[model samples]
Target: MSKDAFAAAALALTAAAENGSNMCLSFLNALPVTHAAISTLGAPFGSETICASDSQAARLEELQIDFGAGPCWDALRTRAPVVDADLSEPTESAWSLLREAIRDTGILSLYSFPLAIGELNVGALDLYATTRAALNLPLIARASALADLAATPVARQVIRRLPHLDTDDTNPATYSRREVHQATGMIIAQMRVNADDAQALLRAHAFTLGRPVREVAADVVARRIKFTRDDVVDRD
Candidate 1:
């Protein structure tokens, strides 16, 4: 982290600690996209809470699984902010599926900002509400300040703690992590390689076969899909 950046973050954290604003380093799932990286209490104590909403996150994950498109996918793929302030309008084309889903849930607008230390898209923070109102300028300003202060340090910290979600449930909205990992292990064994390579092969196969990697991985576990070296070569 640059000396100036470190100084800014230290100052913000110190101020947050002093002002006693709802300061937490958890995840927010308010917008149908749960990001487990970092968050804070951003509400009026009992009136409303703006933390990430699990259902929202799950909904987004579900879109990637079901409809195969949405802001989360774009955000993760592009590593940039995706915003849809007027979902009812056709002009907002970037998040079509996400807009539909949000509409179904009675949420009218949304914003997604990717959290990155650098080139790595650590994750995204989604802020959502029921109206077209822009993010509370003050709140956004505060978050910007906080991010400016802590991003370098926090991003580095997050990277050093690679796979930050390891301590977190793989699927925060569900309890099927073990089944999935077990399936991954089976894929590795069947492919006769390490985990990362196995995962890549699985993803590549899924994209080619027009299926979800999780579904393909499950098939690997269930012995429905045989992973032969020849099959891998044949695909090539």
Candidate 2:
């Protein structure tokens, strides 16, 4: 892509960001990618997709959520970008379901960029291509920048829905516990651990019980689940 194209794409993404849409779409759409999707990763809520350019992108996003593992998950967990220039080349392994589905669709390339806010990991922007090809350095750099710009709007949405996360509200009963951020914070206070560790514990229990993290978090807020220095207590 030319410098002029890059500049125009960036401007489009900025407009999308201000309106709280898929801010990185224009930038990646300018590339060879066939489809793209942005998803927010969180406890209880799991992977909430923000936007997708088309149906293909939407299906892949749903696949990532159902499988609970993919390049998006890897990027979010590592706080870095993940590039799979060819999904068919890798015969087998982790995220097998996602790999197989991608193979079936004949989309051979995948890229994921993490939308990070300092030490906090908010989400990822995923790209899919019908052919096997790597993104050029300039495109990758621009996409990364777009991912960074995207974080602010995504974070704002999270905060707006879960106001208790920003405030020092102690009463859990006052607000809705349908989201996991509040429960995650409650765990942090109870265990005196960092946000990441608190989220890990919450996910651990949810995975163990084959339940959604948000449901598990609601239990925590309702005093059905308690966290201590040693372990987590379950009233149910």
Candidate 3:
């Protein structure tokens, strides 16, 4: 990173700290990426979009949710950076569906950097490029540094919002999808399971119904869907 780029990144991150992760997407403009997104790993919802540079960036992030496989997913799952500078190349065999989706969108490169603090994996920073070219070592280092700087703020926001969600008289849409967290706690109470398994069950039920996790969480919160020991039964 050059001196000017480094200064700009610092200023952008300062702005993000003041507002939220929504302000962080603009930070990627200093890089070669055309579009970008920040996704946080949620308990019941798998990965939820935190912010994006634009609608196109948001849609690129959603490809993982729609198709269930992508570089972002891999990075979060394995706690490693997924660097694919050329999606059109035949070298990628892990996520064929995601590659085709990117190709269809006219994006030629994709990158994912996991946000981890020690053993805890929080989320991922995803980037897209319009041209087909590999990223050099310096560029990769800059990307990694930016991802590291942004991760803590994102993680802190999630933690700060948890208490608010657990209390009474809180809005559901205050911090993105708050119902998802409430529904996760409800599932924990109903099933007497750990957060991980409860969230997995929640996601499985959503997948079975072919609906988004937030929509299913709304049903759960409304007392419309109940999870029994052996089945997810509808109360309606």
Candidate 2 residues 1-236, lDDT tens each? 77778677777876776676665477555677888888888653356887898877888888887788888989888877888877778655688777878779878888899875544456888988888865866777777777766664665555445423223245566455445788888888987766765676666566546665667778888888887753456475
TM-score of each: 0.39, 0.65, 0.64
lDDT of each: 0.45, 0.72, 0.71
Q: Write the per-residue lDDT of candidate 1 for residues 147-199, one digit (tens) a residue.
A: 33332233333223232223334555533556567766876776566665455
- What order do you get sorting by lDDT, best first? 2, 3, 1
Error of 1 at 3 (Å): 22
Global Cα lDDT for candidate 3? 0.71
Q: Note the residue pairs that clash in candidate 3.
A: none
**Which segments of candidate 2 are over 4 A away from where they belong?**
21-24, 163-236
- True-vs-predicted CA distance for residue 5, candidate 1, Å: 20
Superior by lDDT: candidate 1 or candidate 2: 2
- Cα error, candidate 3, residue 78 (Å): 3.1
What tens-digit string does per-residue lDDT give for candidate 3 at 1-236?
68688668867875776575564465566777788888876543346787889999899888876677788778878867788888777764777877887879999988888875443456888888898764566877777777876665666555544422223235555333778888888988887766754565566566545666777788898899877644445577
Q: Estimate the TM-score for candidate 3.
A: 0.64
